[model samples]
Target: MSPTTDADLSDFVFVRRNDGLPIEEIPFELVERKGVGHPDTMCDAIAERASRYYSQYCLEHFGRIAHHWFDKVMLFGGESDLDYGHGELVNPYTVLFAGKGAHRCGDTPIPLADILRRAAADVLSEVTTGFDADRHLVIDCRIVDHQGAGRGRSRYRPESHDDLVAIGDPSLVSNDCNLLHAFAPFSRLEQAVLRIERLINGPDFKARHRDTGWDVKVFGSRNGEDFSFIVNMPFLASDISSFDHYLSRKAECREEVVGLLRDTLGGDPAVLFNPTDRNGRPYLTALGSVADTGDVGAVGRGNRVTGLITPMRAMSIEAPAGKNPLDHTGKLYGVLAQQLARRLNEMTGKPVETHLFTSKEAPLDRPDQVVVRVHGLQDGGDEEQKIRAVVAEALANTAELTREIIVTGVTMW
Candidate 1:
């Protein structure tokens, strides 16, 4: 066969190796996920939404999305005075939005600060729901460079909108070498934990249980056949009147949660609820997230781009938040690796670990290196071909992922 071109991706190589043991033989595994209410997850979410919304606004008004990635976002938690059944924010959260973008589309200047404020407010309202935007949140925007930066820096095309006809794709390949990895078939424990969290934060859950807050977290560990799950959730004091009521609610939540998990997964996983505090005082929060009382948040420090934090997996520590969804391989590779891992596992019907690396300016269609490690496939023959096909299919969705991320802005919960 001939060499593969950039668009064709025919030259891509896939290296596979045995995982030394069968998937079912593995003894222990652990997985963790930071909920949307986590400080770090909040930072990722706010920055991502801000960039995506601004890009959309520009695209609609100027015919092209102006370049901007507000990755460097900081949230300073403020004070909240609270008691059993009542609470109020003594000071609101202070958020700083710092990044570069085109402030002007021709002579008409874009509403820069307005965009920032709206973005921050909208994101907090959507992600951290029930949090008071006007009274309890203070958001500010500081553009790193008001002057236009290069396209690769922020993925802003150099050709002006006025510059009539143009050549090929306006976007360029990744400007830096990015390495990312993910594992196949999320453990049953991981899925169970995520489902419980989404349930707690969902509208139906809230409607039924008004006292339950949205800021919730899930951590799971497995020891042979035994499993342990730790859930951290706070209750709103205003919803419940007395200390007895608080304890009663807590007991009810614990029982129901344990029963739900047992029924859903058919396992005797020990469920621990809010073990951090036993001082007779219930954990109360004015909002769903922990940003209420001096919790800090930073980009890339929260969940992986796939929304689950698998400490055991060979995943990247780099934060994929606030990058241009269209061209930043940092974020794209994270999603790509995850999809490839799932497909490879389905192909071989075994636990799979997939890794992909791309050099600076390399075509996004092809990776500089691709590695697939399977945990004991029954048959080694034809595995390589099947793995390669799976990778090719995953890479093929690069454009689609880019478009979805840039346009819709996928959130990590």
Candidate 2:
């Protein structure tokens, strides 16, 4: 059964459908989660933090978040030499920050350099342990003041703080034509992967096992009832004394993770930790991350807003990080779709998927399409009405959504 078009309004075409398959019922599923210390994720984190800091600075000085976009960020891994028990950084990691931002409000400077440095330092410190951003990383700022071609003029280089007052538009509009999809109730396998990674990176596990590194990636595949996970986790070189010591630590960590999987799924799932480990070489690093070991990364190449990269599910290719919180539907709609999906699911007690799309420069509250798929949608006629009411209410409150995003620093990558 396919979903039917329920309501077609002027601003949005709402489609409510049944026969949507739950993720678990889907025969095959693939979910990947890039850990915080992964270079790509690191870039996303830094970009988002920078945007938040920039927003705060503008709000404090100009009374609103000025027009800016800091989505382009790259982490060029440094060179590091490693052995069984020792590691040395030959060169420091380079964080190349490239994007457009508000450099000045009239004659007053926005202190972009100070904002970027603070953002990068804070994120790097939080993501990795035993690593100092100042000592082990170089910050490069290539941000400029410019907007796209048809945007009238360069809002980034505004004439005065007064010019920035209208930058946060009262009528929030989409900056780009983009689509976002989100669903509620993560599948059991998805939950398992999230839990496993959180455990590995959490403080208690880090305290218990000092050799574990934070640069972890979990790839989970499910075919029918059987599930398997390939976790690429790094081991700190300084914690291992010899080959035997490395094996012992690796074995211990694997056992713990296996136990976690078993507990999560209520079944023994096949688990492999650091499958790339060989005799002469191990998945070892100095600062608990491959980002400092010649591995490069950029934004939009990592996880989606839901924190997992699920190729099997409805997804958007847009990277939401660093976009302005006020009107960029790339960021706002992505977060809104997920929130609406969760709320609808909770309200109807059914698996719900929400997709929102808009045209470039369209009002944020007026999306071109809002497709809601409820697994048991056919059971009730009022469900469609409820869905419309919910979506309409949420859309009407997009201003609040923007405020929430700025205040909470909602995660979207």
Best by lDDT: 2
Report the C-alpha lDDT of model 2 over 1-413, residue by residue, as the tens digit.
01223343534756467575688898999898999889999999999999989988888777877788888999898887788778777788888899888788778888999898888888888877677766787889999886778664547778876566444365557778888999988998788888888899999999898788889999998999899999988888877888788878889999999999887786889988888876567788987789867899998899999999988889888898888887788898899999998899899998889988899877666778888888877655777787887887787777777777776788874
Give me candidate 2's TM-score against the actual structure: 0.94
How far out, in Å, is residue 17 in model 2?
Answer: 1.5
The digit string of per-residue lDDT tens for model 1 on 77-184 reads: 878777877866679888887776666655667777887777777767765546777787787777754434343322233245542111114344664688988887
Model 1 misses residue 273 by how many Å?
Answer: 0.7
Which residue pairs show collisions in model 2? 106-159
**Native-to-model Cα distance after best TM-score fit, residue 293 in candidate 1, in Å:** 1.2
